[model samples]
Target chain A: SQQGEEDPQALSIQEGENATMNCSYKTSINNLQWYRQNSGRGLVHLILIRSNEREKHSGRLRVTLDTSKKSSSLLITASRAADTASYFCASGNKAAGNKLTFGGGTRVLVKP
Target chain B: GAGVSQSPSNKVTEKGKDVELRCDPISGHTALYWYRQSLGQGLEFLIYFQGNSAPDKSGLPSDRFSAERTGGSVSTLTIQRTQQEDSAVYLCASSLVASGSLNTGELFFGEGSRLTVL
Candidate 1:
């Protein structure tokens, strides 16, 4: 598993259900961020959780980071069909010149 | 444009040919970056630019790949002797500031330019 790599590459859930995705990294990070991409489009920023923070939320989305475990997770509550897209996690580490490295991403399919 | 704009949305070229992709970042944004995504692959960082000068290009795959930003606004990514392996969606993003304590995680991205090398 590479740094900023997410598991459950593909997921399917019925509308109104909650969905969760996981990401793990090898190195210490200054912050972790989530992103969403519609088909054939550029990514859109979703949320950011700093190393010092354990959990953060934005509307229907929630993000948690555990530095001790070198992992992070993204949760989407009350998922709708519009939530179908690819989700990626990115790691930002100061030791690495503060550039972001993106993960492979999870392909989410929210069925109506 | 109200958002980041990219030119030549799609380009198809023969192998060994040179190609240029352009990106116009949002107005008043001072930081820009270039990234590429191969099919089924994650976004790969190509370079980072602050103002008109690039400070980090270690992610560029080879010498054949080069990028330059001018006037602190528009940027051009040039690929020399393009190869089939270079086929990908080239994406450009901009932020209000460079990566640091004050940096926000949000990045405004342009619809990527899809490049196909035959």
Candidate 2:
């Protein structure tokens, strides 16, 4: 079974708008990492938030994790056309052998 | 020089034939993983290897699929008697550690090998 499930399968917004995607997981996770993938390309690691951390920021990206709700959200502020890609959230469980269980992913389209 | 690498970026083979995909993890990285992604779908975990520990093959779809990591660095995934349903992008990733304690378990992914089983 997949551990993570991302909401809003697809999203389209203007270049400067803010885009947010949510992910929910079933089991307790050691950490959650976000990645970006261009069409037909390998995933690029973006950010990782440990279970002990509540929020993390890098560049224009902000990720918030709420273990109480078993959910996490990735926020891309002032989105750019370059940010148009598929965003995935992978949850890592200690018992899962460090293998990341990826979500279905959220495809974001930034219209310039 | 610091990323995972996969071979045969694309492959096409007839059904019932066998295909092999290779992956080279980053230097000194002890953790490796394999995944399959069908069109418009999420990635499915296949297997995992961490150092000398026993591999975790619980995610393999069937007995037809198997993977091996040599010297704790390079790995290969093999599928026998392939079916059309097996046609998908096979991805490989490696991490610095098997536990999330260090490195946050961020995996370095390879450009997946797209397999087309006709």
Which candidate should be chosen as best, given DockQ against the real structure?
A: 2
Candidate 2 error regions (>4 Å): none
- Per residue, candidate 1 scores C-alpha lDDT tens digits across B43-73 of 8889988765546898899999998888888
Specify the highest-lDDT model's number: 2
Native-contact recovery for every candidate?
0.41, 0.61
Task: Write down the TM-score for model 1.
Answer: 0.95
For model 1, which pairs clash? none
* Per-prediction DockQ: 0.60, 0.69
lDDT of each: 0.89, 0.92
lDDT tens readout by residue for model 2, A1-112: 4689999899999999999999999998899999999999999999999998999999999999999999999999999999999999999888666678999999999999
RMSD of each: 1.4, 1.1
Model 2 TM-score, 2 decimals: 0.97
Candidate 2 predicts chain B with a TM-score of 0.95
In candidate 1, clashing pairs total 0
